[model samples]
Target: MLTRAEDGLENLWDSRRAAGMSEPEKLLCRSNLLGSDKRITNYGGGNTSAKVMETDPLTGAQVEVLWVKGSGGDVGSIRMDGFATLYMDKLRALKGVYRGPEHEDEMVGYLPHCTFNLNPRAASIDTPLHAYVPHRHVDHMHPDAIIAIAASRDSRALTAEIFGDEIGWLPWKRPGYELGLWLEQFCRDNPEAKGVVLESHGLFTWADDAGDCYALTLDVINRAMAWFGQKTHGTEAFGGPVRTSLEPRARAAVAARLMPAIRGFVSGGQHMVGHFTDAPEVLEFVNARDMARLAALGTSCPDHFLRTKIRPLVVDFDPAAPDVDAVLGGLKASVEAYRDDYAAYYGRCRRAVSPPMRDPNAVVYLVPGVGMITFARDKATARISGEFYVNAINVMRGADAVSEYRGLPEQEAFDIEYWLLEEAKLQRMPKPKSLAGRVALVTGGAGGIGAATAERLLREGACVVLADIDGDAVAEVGKGLAAGHSADVVRTVTMDVTDEDAVAAAFDRAAVAFGGIDILVSNAGIASSAPVEETTLAMWNRNMDILSTGYFIASREAFRLLQRQGMGGAVVFVGSKNALAASPNAAAYCTAKASELHLARCLALEGAEKGIRVNVVNPDAVLRGSRIWSGEWLDQRASTYGTDKEGLEEMYRNRSMLKRSVFPEDIAEAIYFLASDLSAKSTGNIINVDAGNKDAFTR
Candidate 1:
């Protein structure tokens, strides 16, 4: 449901293996981006940057430069170490620039340092845009589900209804200097705004802290995508030319017919246009299709005048009409008329006056059965615009195969064409959920952590299964749950995470008992601390058997079943803050817990292809009474705190910035957020429910 930039940017931001970043702090900063939303990006679709003071390599003096995520890194996995150094002045100077769309030779020549010299990485197309961000870090991504819905015909209206004042929708533009300039001014005007949702494009969010950038960007996209998903008609097939090419002669021919339609659509029965593009995806698609039909969708965005001219030469070529020159003559005439109408429309409606009003902003070419053609200044803009018109055409196609395709009544399209209404409807919102039919499976379901989570999920009305190694405990809780109000209700199953057979059997039981599991909580864990020198193999095995191996068992089983059904589900591991921060005499316990975090992170990606979400819940110092916190351990813990039972319990309540230690219930709520309908797009994030306990540095 979410469309991401090609997986080229996967692993850009993340907590672990930020192996190539130049600093340690960025690693800590980047990890905070993962969450239960699809707003910023789904899986890995965007990139980020930090402007740090560094000595210029050539100048040998202290100067400012950007350390941005390398092109291929995943933002979710990105760390300060993954950043590539580039001169800031060089990047900001890219504005007012122009070049060949494909090579972008002039722009590329302007910044030689953007290339990393090793590992064959190119700066992201949004490099100029990132340079424009005033913050220390900048993030950008195509949140699939969100942008996909935002690009549709009714996007402005729908987004208006959902988010009244938090969004800023910019018309699509090629990703580069111009867009950066536009955004820089936008961010300045609305300094407090969370993000800018580029129409027919993606999202942009930034902050001084990498975590803030990651979290805000992700949260916004999730909310937008969720809003769109409900109203969108997700048909299995929405056809468009899988291809298009601008052979010189072919281009001229398509322009003839498309020009008239476009003019009529733009004006009051008004104008037409020609188009061009150099994006790899658009070029790839264009070169593969019949020129005529490919021209119809035109280019990425309607305003992409550079690659795609504003109305093309449209000639309906067929064997029956053999006069080629006459066709060409017809095409030129149509392009002329289209151009004239555009001038009149611009004169009447556009707020500012500019010369060359006759210059068409897009181009289209048509061939009989082959469909239509459109073009733009570059491939990116062309693709965005093409998709918009294509959706409109598809909607109008009706049962007649021969679509009398038209733009939303010409008047409406014209008003929206330059509507400043984007701002009137933009509004930031605290997150909201609309899930009703979703389901979930929480491991450690019968116990404290899992029980707390199950209760929260149940309140959300999800049909759930209480799974645990303690069969009696699971049964006891399962029976106590009220089933009358919930859908398909609750199922209790005994599962041993370390037992592959039992894990498989348990999932199957969940499937039969409640239809199919939708969310999974791998909360079942055994925590025991011991110094590395004194730790016994038996203790190590115990931790591994239950924490690490048991976790894999649950996740692996869930993935297999979830994949079989072709729908998606979410999984959350109850990881401890001890995994990220250091603690003395807890090596074995730490190692097991740390492994669970990585397990979820890696699986977050692996499960992405199947729509199953995977993330971790890292809670700090929860003093819940579990097996490890037995009477003796509790007494020992209480003694260390210099307090009685109540005082010992109160210590964590004021541990961090929030003056609170993580409660089993608090972690459970966070898990519910990740596993439910609200977090449909989130995966691979290590959610810190530690109330700021592991603030990395002593800041």
Candidate 2:
């Protein structure tokens, strides 16, 4: 049974309440409690509320208030301030005047006016529904278990039979003032009902106390699940896909062909990354007996439509195509047709006064035998939407196990997708940061400077590929970045840049993961300090191979990929101060950096024709966070300089005109400027990031 975590609930509220904490604290606690359970909600999926008493600023008297979860806050991690406080009297008054026909828009607009504070965070669109429900605490969620029961064709009959009139049933009503008013009256009439099932939207359970409300929600879903389990015979209907496997190499090649083509078509030729998945669960759903019909249904919930879209687009694929380019061309045509069909679907349902329609690009793409690909402007969005669809597939399976899976009607899906209240939420979102649609690749990305550059690119909204020789470290770093950004944004490749074959394959992986690469930061290198007499041929070759040869390999591959893309691109090489001013006992390092700098200049000359910019960033004495400056290396370097590590670092810092040490972030900033369009007019230029080292200045 789905039970409440009440072990310390009262103690938490009592302790926090003693410190002038309000009811929002209690509400947020319950919100977090429910949201922590993915079976209840995931990410920012659900909202919650509590009615409390607060002093009215104007009247200087205690008044009833409705504290509902607000925008930009996830219930899973909500704070006390995350709930927007509104006067219950004003909200209740809205129900008296709200008329039919898109009153949801006016209700949303009026919510801010009814706020206790003059300038309050915008309340969620469901505030009216919370206001109308005469309960102290209200919990709303789109639980997969409950959805399986609620979204079935026989939902009403099943709900009535299971709950025995203990719950109210509301047919799909497009969530607005109309539904809010109707739901309020329905609940008042059915005083004994503890919860209400909104056909396909979600479940609403309420009680006089927060714990009771949360417990009520869990109890209702558990009962529905029990009934569903008994009816379904232990869920054997939704089995894994027909067992068929493709060799990894061949599967990768198919993705490489179709990813970029679909990206180009979806973005109208703009740059974007294609995130591909063929996980076991996804394969099972795509290869199900009724794949087409199952995939054509709407999203698991109305909230999901904003992310996953109404339905995924299913297309045919030929993994064994002899000509890759021909297959790409065919996929492009198919995507165009999908776009046309989306536009037609829009035309059929749109009202004259609807906001300008959204882009008709498909969010999720299903290819029989190949796998699933979800398209988004950025990797984070693509990953989130992909996750929602994966959940949807599982939910659909569960629903099918019990009964026929039925989602909202086609017109209702359109209504929610373009609803003005939801549109307002998007309107309030911050503008996209620069480099939003671009994709970047960083070599030695697991290291300090390279990792910093990758993080910077991700913050600027670019999908990033972190390529490093240390596969394990780079994958771990990518995972951390993906947790904050999108899963597809940071892809890792274990590559020895000197290996031409590995370089080529890494580029193919990037193409498959994110369509194509637009910017390449060649920053992978190791530090070697030794007397010229003591430097061995092996040491010299090692530095030369990874430094100069690696730059050549990565740059060559980037150029080929960008040239084929026919889009302007950039290549940035991370050189060193040794290239500009020779350092003692650094013969191999100096010689290789000089060669890499000159190589960048040569690439700039060739790449200029194709609108590709090439540049180099030369940084000096960047000891902090550098793997090169750790443990024995630091001790060795300090001994070579006849001082302790700290003293040596200070000496290097004071040697510069700025009297400060350079950081990896300093070099990363210079690289970003050169790689982005801000440096469009400049190419083949060396940007120095040595904190004003006179000798390292480009001359």
Candidate 3:
């Protein structure tokens, strides 16, 4: 049975209000409450609204306003500003001149003009639908149980049987002003009805109060689930579990061989990242006897058209395939065939007014025995698309278990695939970053320099693997990055860089996670300070193990993976300014850095043949968050400078030509430039991120 979060509704509202919740905040809370439950909505799906009273600037009087969730705001963590307040009367007046269908653009344009507040947030495309409803509160969500019935061939009859006359049904209509008007009129006619179901779209439940509306929505969904359970006699979705002969290691090996081939075919010269998954559920579903036929029907809902397209590409696989090359060839052929079929489908149903055709590549590629591959311009988008397919697979199985699986016709699918609103949103997005489809690995990722570099790479649209000996700290760092991007973009692995076995395992995990790596940041190191006479053997070994030998191990693994993939890549070693400008008590420290710098140059000379570029970033005195500048080291540096800790920090900042303190982020930016294609032709070079320390300049 599906879980419902109706407990403590009144208490939650009271607590939120006492904590100073505005109308929008309350609405956001409700939206998040619904969105938090995956069964109710997935990713950015679903929207909510509340009728609020706001001051009219012109008349200085209170006015009724509709505060609704805005586009691109995930309902789970929506903020107060996430809502766009619109004048209800102005939106209602728009229906008089509504020119039937093909008004998606016109309607979208009109909604913004009707905003009560001068703030120009784009309300959801379903704003008109919410405005037309008479209730003080309204919600629309795509719940799995409800959609399973709605997407079935018998949706209308089944819905009627379940709800009787408590709810009304609207035939599938493209969301526009006209449909909103029809929904308003339908609600007026059926005043006794609790809500309405948009056939093959979603559910709308409303009440004068927010809590009641939410409760009603849950009650209705619970009824649907109960009915489905009785009909299916409690059989689990996908029938029975099907075990795979290949274990995890073998599955990853197959994925490693097939990922590049699939990416090569789908990318068509443009960059694309491929993500593989062999979760227990995925393995069972893909291995089912009739997997291909079942998945070929269509997406679980029209909302998925932009992401997963109408259907997934199901690649035929034989577990007994003789070699990796054979499997790769099969994967390549399947992708090419999918592209051809997609072109044909588009040709048959495209409208003259349709937007330019998107790349004819399938977002989802399913390998029956191995697993599934999801592709997109970036790792985050690829993972989101993959998640949608996972949910759809479940819904499809449920629909089959209860009734027959049916989806929208080809023309209907084309309509949503080319929807104007979706296109407009895409146009407004910033262009993909230079490293959009690339994957990066950073050592010392739990600390200052490594974490900052990882964040910079994430912003540039590269999937990152953060490796550090601090396992828990790196996990927390990964969590923070995941919040801003997709979880697939940042992976954390705990490793002592000196361990060859650990380094190999981390690289292997990264390859399986994001197909392969494109950039390597060898930033992991320890700092030691002592005169040649006072330097201890233990201190010397520690510095060399983590600094010189550690860098060699990580760089070698990176080279191995890039060689295996036969793709050109970049590697940046994080050497120190001390490598060039030695300080009097830094014997072991300076020697290890100097050696590492040359190591990078050596790799560059050899790697150039295979299209790999190697470089070094030398940073000086980045002490704010540096894990290296602490404990007795701080006191020793202060004493050497004839001052306290704070004065010594100031002395270092003034010593630089820029007369400013260098930050870890400064180093990250330099690393980013070298890691990206912007430095494609430049290698065997050193970039200084030391706020202009003249003594450290290579020239």
Candidate 4:
């Protein structure tokens, strides 16, 4: 008796596509189709399952196997291996042993015993909810439209009004064994019901057919959306807008300043990457009159609360009289107050056996007129946190428009937040890489050494911003790196190192893109090989403009941003062996390189107090993969050394103490050491990556 709505949700299921699919494959297809839309569920926020008859590995007898999305898996991107297989009989038998809600945490340990075919994928905590549904297929989703109704003050009445007897409703209870049983009982009572809405939680739908189950989930959400649309039509959302939004450029400028300041305060233990959004929904909610009241109440859904924290820190900034500097000055105090409030919440809610308090810092920050900013240990998490807050905002908008919106009770939220199972999940997460939360900005990033350094940093879990004069080349390199590592960690900007404004803008972009920069690799340079008699003013100026002046500008901008962040930073200058060896017929290049080396020493001395370390990596004859070697500089150096272009590399190698050919990757390795914590205590020093060049050795 289920009817599909004319609008709101699309039926993406291709019967042709599912024609040859097995039951497990059909379940996966349905899960993916449902998860593909943000309107259906946020990332990693929903679970889907199917009970299929599979032959037992040992007995060769067919049994009902429950295939469900495994722990920490996103249905949209899940593969066959991501589904945990368990015996349905064993799952049902768990009901007899389950004592009560107080002992629900122990039930998670019993899941592994119910494993069918020894599937290695760990079953998620929501397994019982799907197992107890009493249907061949089940879907549990956190669609915004459905959650809007679930989180409303009259959630039960609203559910009845919208779907009548087709869908049932359950009161708020933390998701676990008891709630799964509650779902089973609800089904047993309402035999005509197709699904049920869990108050302040999400929607659960079931069907004997996978296609019908998928369609029912969409149909239920669509009905809710349609009903809310009609009931709340023409109503003001979140009590309407109280403030005007700043222009796009102005908003970005404010975010560039505010993000780094906030990052400095919260990143005391580890660096945090940031994500900023000025989407229409975020702007509408932040600028609304009831923003403070609604945000204070917190998010209703446990998934939303978990990612965005109990509540966001509302930044004190008025768009009417925008003064970003004033906001920046008071940022530390604001952040500290939020931490103190969070600590007090923990104190009031902590149980005798509760896990120790986590990072007291706020994850979401709301600035009226600008937008929302979220920070986490890494870029993806930060971005995902922002998305979850947007979902919360949508829920509030709908719930407040029709009926009063309700957040979970404080004790209930506290129990879920500090639950032992949640703590164990956190403990089981893999240890983060050394450079996990660090962000780096590399000049000349399109070049071989620059790209290699970016790769090295990214491999160790650092976000990298590639800046270079060649826009196309830098973008191409950024694209390739983004493909390897995620696009979240790689950003590219076209920059002229000698242009003061361009240099500052690039750093600001870096701040807005990934919070702020922690490491600066000053590698932009030019080479000119002319005898003293032939060295014109133009040639000398060109070398100095790029090598000396450019390095100074880039470093100065990096220092300014690092100071703004209040976090210590690293500056690694890509100098040359010629700076010390006094190469013939290259006076201009040698002089510029030496200037760069001396500048690093001065910066090292000045920045030591602030924990910013500056050092130099000197490479002699980096002929392979070097843009300098690809140009006229190679022919000029070969002519000077009385050798052909092909033999020039060999001549330089023979001149070195080790007689080994140097490549860009070799130089990159030295730069990485100097830029990372490996050289934390060794500043104002020079590393000769010239394959053992005695002439370039520092005494």
Give the top-scoring candidate (TM-score): 4
Model 1 residue runs over 4 Å out of place are 1-433, 483-488, 625-628, 631-647, 695-699
C-alpha positional error of residue 298 in candidate 2 after TM-score superposition, expressed in Å? 3.2
Q: Which candidate model has the greater lDDT, 1 or 3?
A: 3
Model 2 clash number: 1
* Ranking of all candidate structures by their lDDT, best first: 4, 3, 2, 1
> Taking the tens digit of each residue's C-alpha lDDT, what string does model 1 give over 1-699?
222433222224554534455442663356434412333343334667777776666667876777666544556666555556676765755554554343352464455555432323445545667778788877676554445444556555545565565766666555655676788898888887666767655667778765556556656655654553444445222243443445534543334333323333332211112232233333333333333443343322222222234334444454234454565456546656766766676666555422223334334443442344554322223343454433332222221122122222223334334433221222222222233334567788777777777778777656577888889988877776644433235678888888888787776555433334567788887766556787899988988888888888888888876664456678888888777876666677788888888898899889988788898888876778354565554665566566776776567677676786566788878888888656777788777887777553222
Better of 1 and 4 by lDDT: 4
TM-score of 4: 0.98
- C-alpha-based local distance difference test score of model 3: 0.81
Which regions of candidate 4 deviate over 4 angstroms?
1-7
Better of 1 and 2 by TM-score: 2
Q: lDDT: which is higher, 2 or 3?
A: 3
For all candidates, the clash counts are 116, 1, 1, 0
Point to the candidate with the largest lDDT. 4
Error of 3 at 631 (Å): 6.7
